[model samples]
Target: MTNTNRASIKIGGGVNGSKVEGGKIRTEKSTSSTENNVDIIIDKDVTNSAEIIGGEIHVSSDLKAEIQELLNELAKNPITRKEAVAIEVIKEHINDNPSLKQRLLSALKAGGTEALKAIFNHPVVSVSVETVKGFLEAS
Candidate 1:
């Protein structure tokens, strides 16, 4: 033989069916006492999330700086064969790492067409830029 026990929880007045609009959640309440008015507000910027290739991609600042350094190195005039190979390796790494690719795409989006041109003009780096372009086009 076995015994069964049950319990129920009941919640009282609260904000119901609240929806986020323009990156904000707002709720207001008032009591019989004039001083008892209550207000709740939350604010956030969702625009950046919309701009990113993937929903809210997060890359560390250090990684972003390091990638920028690599791009700057590639952009330098009279690049050597070793540097070209290194660029290829970087491309491979970007392809292998989704975060890095997202970071690259974010940088490109931030910099716009001029940045795209700069990357595309470099024969060694253009391959990776093309890959990024394909992602942009697909999205």
Candidate 2:
């Protein structure tokens, strides 16, 4: 679900939590001094699929850096062959691995797009994966 979704989601006031299922994300208008917000908690079930998918989807640090060295690669660059492979892997993994998808999505947001790219570009992947794995497990 995309928080960008502008639908006015009418709901009961006493929500311990609110979340969108599947591809839909909900964003709510704010009444407090704080800004409007939407939150998506990564699901418990999606973790394994995300890891296997993310692993198969690797690209070289060189390729990732070349893409990031530019200005706003996400908006401007067509998906590179390198990225395409990863995307396909992710798509397949996410098909049934919602938990992993949520965890990865959580990571991507914990650090926004650029930081996410830098992490992906990390040269030492085993350590990087373990770091991410440990962080996820610890949490």
Candidate 3:
């Protein structure tokens, strides 16, 4: 199944950061010295099908499962000699798969850190995924 979504959004300002409140999106201009909060109300007609937790939007559980399944498939071919080397192997494996990288980036953007923790928490996959997660966040 495809995971594309479309939404009609109304933005009021040049938002650098955002949060959802009362089904509306509020934005803020991120700065080092002063914080400028701008409240941008979304249209009442606009609806979201994805899950939301603690004001953060997240991908569906099915998507998370799919990500886990793909990671498991990748993990089937072992390439770890030690704990440190295992992380590198996992990073290389993820980097080698464009589709997987795209899916992971999508999940990370949609679900934030919590979603990443849930997907990569598996004992066998955690180290590698964690390493990749750091790189993803940095970039």
Candidate 3 regions off by >4 Å?
A: 1-82, 128-130
- For 60-137, candidate 3 gives per-residue lDDT tens digits of 455456655655665666654344765665567667877766777877676554456555544465455466678776
Greater TM-score among 2 and 3 belongs to 3
- Candidate 1 clash pair list: none
lDDT of 3 at 96: 82
Candidate 2, residues 46-80: lDDT per residue as tens digits? 33324211111222333333323332333343452
lDDT of every predicted structure (CA atoms): 0.41, 0.34, 0.49
Candidate 1, residues 1-139, lDDT tens digits: the string is 2111122222233334443222111111222111111122334333323331212212234544555556657656444224556556566667777876775576456443323333333334333455446654454
- Using TM-score as the measure, name the better of candidate 1 and candidate 2: 1
> What TM-score would every model get versus the actual structure?
0.31, 0.26, 0.44
Candidate 1, lDDT over the whole model? 0.41
With a 3 Å backbone cut-off (N, CA, C), the pairs that clash in candidate 2 are 1-23, 1-24, 1-25, 2-25, 45-99, 46-98, 46-99, 46-100, 47-99, 47-100
Sorted on TM-score, best first, the list reads 3, 1, 2
Lowest summed lDDT over 10 consecutive residues: which window, candidate 3? Answer: 27-36
- Report the lDDT of model 3 for residue 109: 71
